[model samples]
Target: MTENATGGEVTFADMRLRPELLDVLSALGYEEPTPIQKEAIPPLTEGRDLLGQAATGTGKTAAFALPVLERLTPQGDGAGPVALVLVPTRELAIQVSEAFHRYGRILGARVLPMYGGAPFGRQLQAIKRGVDVVVATPGRALDHIGRGTLDLEGLRTVVLDEADEMLDMGFADDIEAILAATPATRQTVLFSATLPPRIDGIARRHLSDPVRIEMGHTAGEGRETTPLVEQSAYLVARAHKPAALGRLLDIEAPTAAIIFCRTRDEVDQLTETMNGRGHRAEALHGGMEQEQRDRVMSRLRAGTADLLIATDVAARGLDIEQLTHVVNYNVPSAPESYVHRIGRVGRAGREGVALTLVEPREHRMLKAIERVTRQRIPVERLPTVADLQARRMELTRAALEECLLQDDLESFHAVVESLTDEFDLMEVALAAVKLAHESSGATPDEEEIPEVAPRAVDKRRGPRESAHDGERYQRGPGGGMTRLFFSVGRSAGIRPQDLVGAIAGESSLSGRDIGAIEIADRFSLVEVPQAAADEVIAALRQATIKGRRPTVRRERDTRGRRPR
Candidate 1:
């Protein structure tokens, strides 16, 4: 590790990182460490307790996971977990566990994920058999401890991930109990987005002479002070949002952009809508299988999918260097979330753009975001049909200019000369230009997209809050049936089969318990027996359907009737 002139730490290439882990990072195109990683990794590898203050998507997981892998003992048959990671949500648990698995694969590390709605018996068996690392949610881990199914005697490191979110969710007691159960001498690492009083208290009580690392954005001389993201918004009527978004895409023509929706059904619907508009769009949510999610990401990285419609949770730790834009299909509810969403772009000093589609009512939230970032987000008018045509024509002209400059036109010159005898030279040139424009689909027509009234902002709705809420599902009169609503639909590249398969496989529920599924443009509604609603929701909560998380809740009927 090297210290910079500004007293900030830097990770040098010569610093030790496991060869296998480095190989994986190289394969993933991660060359340098993030600021947090540079400061946190050295101390963590030295077995010192660490309290890190950094927000999500800062590459903190790797900062800790690398140390954990470096310090853990080799696996033996049924040797019990050596490193334990506690997270707030099951999705996070799975994500952390996968990270450990990916980094430790060459070391033959056995990583197991234990969370609610998963088979407790299977998890218990895995614990009994032994694992190098255990990633679990606090509630479920505590349950395992109480049942004497998990052993922490051999633990070498304990990581409290997203500590602030856990505290916010009222898991302080559970966390304390789990910490007390672990060995007193074990190294403890706590990572939180904010160092609130509660987190400070935990650090004082749990960590011994720990190193504190904080990272902040700094303005440098001759270096750009602005964030890499060129932030902007488009004002449009609620009903014309889809059209507006499509038109904007047509104009900007980003190589790749992630369109963020608040709910899984919204991701699905938006993906479908974009696809219908002749864009190669894909949807990613939590309700999908790990394998399917991998495929979607593969396609995105391979440039097969230009637009990815996703939810915040489902897109965590997603690093796409080719990404040139981020579209907030809905304004984020919180400033922190907005920061994370836009942070995906504007990385490594690359120029990027963040485009938010703000409805009339969301203007206030947009203002709040600007205030928090201390940056002015320029508001722009929605793209008009004429504007789109102009942009497309410009693109067509640019492509033709490039062809004329670089292409070997000798072969085409003979063909052009033959046609010149019968056709006027200007006429032939116009015809060629017209053919090029048409082939590129750069010609725009004047068909207006149908508008839908903007629905009232659902105060109770959001990806994180609704993740664990039980009220999103409704039970039938007989108490035997339940229906859940997803904010994703056909437009988000979601199918009924994707929802059914995800719930049935990831949860303790069966296919017979799942009933009808209705997919729309911005959302989808699925019915399951009331007996299995909770289990299905918990199961799908962590699962990624269509490479995003299905904001699963009890469905409210068209008449506004909710299941009992």
Candidate 2:
């Protein structure tokens, strides 16, 4: 197995793939095959059943997709797919389908993705018309087959991507059932990050004389020793995470990134928080519809959305072109999950960064991942205000230089000439630069996010004692919900949904975490679960109610009601 220099140069020609695929690869600027691509493509192209162990971002999609495209002869007026790629999640099914479409444009391969959330009618129609490839989640694929909407009789290749995850999600029966329907002579391939006995059992049962390829194939560099994922972890308190994440993003300044959160609520909340901080971020989770998911992906691919905050399941199989960073909002529950999250970056000779926020209590989880991966995730401190200032200055300087290069001075000469008569040229230039800097979106007035205890606290505590409004009653007599008072109310045209959306977006809390809402003409009272009151307040500090900043604080009671 050959590894190009760490992110080195090579060509699809070296792999001796089909000439049509080579042309498409060249057009896509795929100058070299990734480790998995280089290794797996050869045997796969020869129509061999194979088992591959590779993580995401290892170019596994291309590894399998390219060979499938190559072996496919022109369809002879057939309505059934020649190849099938089965993934564990709907997001993955769509991503894999897109990859096939991308790589096989020259071959005129008709690729379709079928999954549960989407309208069944569309998938049914596509299959009826005809398709070259079908990428589907196991359950949805089985559902179609049962309804006689999808036919697998003519399948030439069947790929089980993330085979272990499918089994873990309880799709083993569906997979077995699907395979049973496909011809026994069909080529069977399986790719996974790790091989449990379950995966081994599937390979043994399904594959015939399969070729095995492992992913950590490194060439001349010592990259195998360090690994290219640039893994790191941060020890952060739960309360400070929102502010801390903002500060770190300012320093890192990723081209595009995926921030992994554990739950749909966290994904939505972080998505909102990032947007509030002047970031273009999209949220993806199970709660979102197929249409919403499509729009989020479209925005991300169009480069209009830079940050994608998603839960693990929602992010499965995504392969974005300019993604440079992967941030885990919290350490994942399992080492395999950590592996999967970071696998989204460090693809195809790209230098990628993987950052994880580790609560003190979750430090063990991080270390466990380290033990499994056999690489230490360095703990990084949050960037300071001075550091952010330096980054901003660098950005401002870069922006100014770029504009100077691209903009013609002929038109702007009049303004500079007019200002030069009153002020020195140097002073005038500095003033113009100040205006550009002001519009650059860097907040020089950003205060530092306070540090919390070195170790994580078991129970939520106020980050600081409330210094404004009524006395805080966070932990009520019954220890359930605490009422918060916002200075803006019905007069400001704020509704419960607005408050709920804002709270869910800005803070770590979800809509369900909030209890009751009482709105008056000039003021409002809302009950939030006791534990998250401080976090909600922290998130709101950087937010606006009715496009204006308002006082949001813990209320002593909801008794006071007054009209505007």
Candidate 3:
């Protein structure tokens, strides 16, 4: 799970599952249970409450899903749902629901995925008809419960999948409400990638003497071990990021990759740019409808698209088997976020790569991520045009070698003989290789990316790092700082911590990146890095501040006037 291969090759059959389930596992080509599953299934099947911490692709779903199905009982015609799974987003809800369906189909289990954007009538009808399991997002699940259409009193088991993500999305209250409605004696299982204090509080309050399991990356004692992922970063100016990313992808030749951006606007723009550069890229964000998102996912899984350009929230809970690379368009604002994004690749013991594009000014935040993750992310130079050319030539050579191995050359022998008759044999072979390279679609590289070095941070000045040095209310992009205006202030119960948390949660900025804060009667002003100003504004626009849609933008110069 943590780029390390799962523990000893323990087969699913060794777990004593139902013969039918074992048969299905074999049919599906599943060889063994992952580390989480190996440790979790026995206790879960015994009906013990569990609190599991695992990364994204750790097979946690099966660890819980199989037990839920194994314990499933035959319900009466109008019985309430027996099991409930709460995920963070509609995409995850659908994905988890599909997994339950696939694994439980032979058992005649009824599963429903309830989320917003779908017709309420459909979900209502399905619930009334009765189901064995219901996979739902917290908000929509609470909505049904409030409407008196969903009954949780009969639930024998309740699962909080991706509990940390749900809490981050402000579903803590809804989760508490939903759990309160469930049977008090029911088995509770909480799975989170990271267990913060808040998650611990939930587990203590809800679970009854739960069994705890920690999987994925864990720092050792006073020593640094290499992560399973090949982590690296490139410090480049913002303008050259797109080109640099394209160059890196060409050199890596990833089987499939996901490029994470800060906002939907960024996802869209980069998706278009990557596609124009001839990469089969797809964009996924909260802005798209469920159907559109499903189509994009289908294409990627079917190998029609090799690159997925997505926002963080939209790509949650996705497990793509062929994914070999994860790219951070910008360094993550939160250190935990860096762990989550790269966890998508290098899973289940496969070698994978994690790439990041860091701007010169954001170097300090990158260091913060490294400190938190306890892994060194080497800042490597961008691949030059010459490097790209050499990679392309290598690819051409490999392709020709494969063709020679797999293709019959009898037909080409006649053409080769004809060409060699009029020219030297060596010259004819050179001409053929040139034609093969050209026909292989190796585009000529014309530009070299400018090199950039991270700005030196003066540790004596503390982490603020000249964040308040120049024009406190500068409107446009530059080096020092830019003032951002917010609509909510003291009246909305806004505080400086609230401002910092909002920006840090939504954008690729940490607490260290924010400078001074000025809260007025009707609005607030915060200084953020000029380099990340646009990204922060874009991310915040898509988010709510202090439970209100605050108008966020650059601070207008008002040197001589009193604040409104």
Name the Cα RMSD for model 3: 13.6
Q: Is candidate 1 or candidate 2 better by TM-score?
A: 1
Best by TM-score: 1
List, residue by residue over 124-239, the lDDT tens digit for candidate 2.
78877899899987666776787788888789999999775565444666788899999988999999766779889999999999999865432222223336689777777778
Q: Which is the better candidate, 1 or 3, if ranked by lDDT?
A: 3
The best candidate by lDDT is 3
Angstrom error at residue 521, model 1: 40
Number of backbone collisions per candidate = 38, 0, 0
lDDT of each: 0.74, 0.74, 0.77
Q: Which ranges of candidate 1 are over 4 A from the true structure?
A: 1-12, 76-78, 217-223, 226-230, 233-249, 253-373, 376-438, 442-563
> Candidate 2: misplaced stretches above 4 Å?
1-10, 217-373, 378-564
lDDT score for candidate 2 against the true structure: 0.74
Which window of ten consecutive residues has the lowest lDDT sum in model 2? 454-463
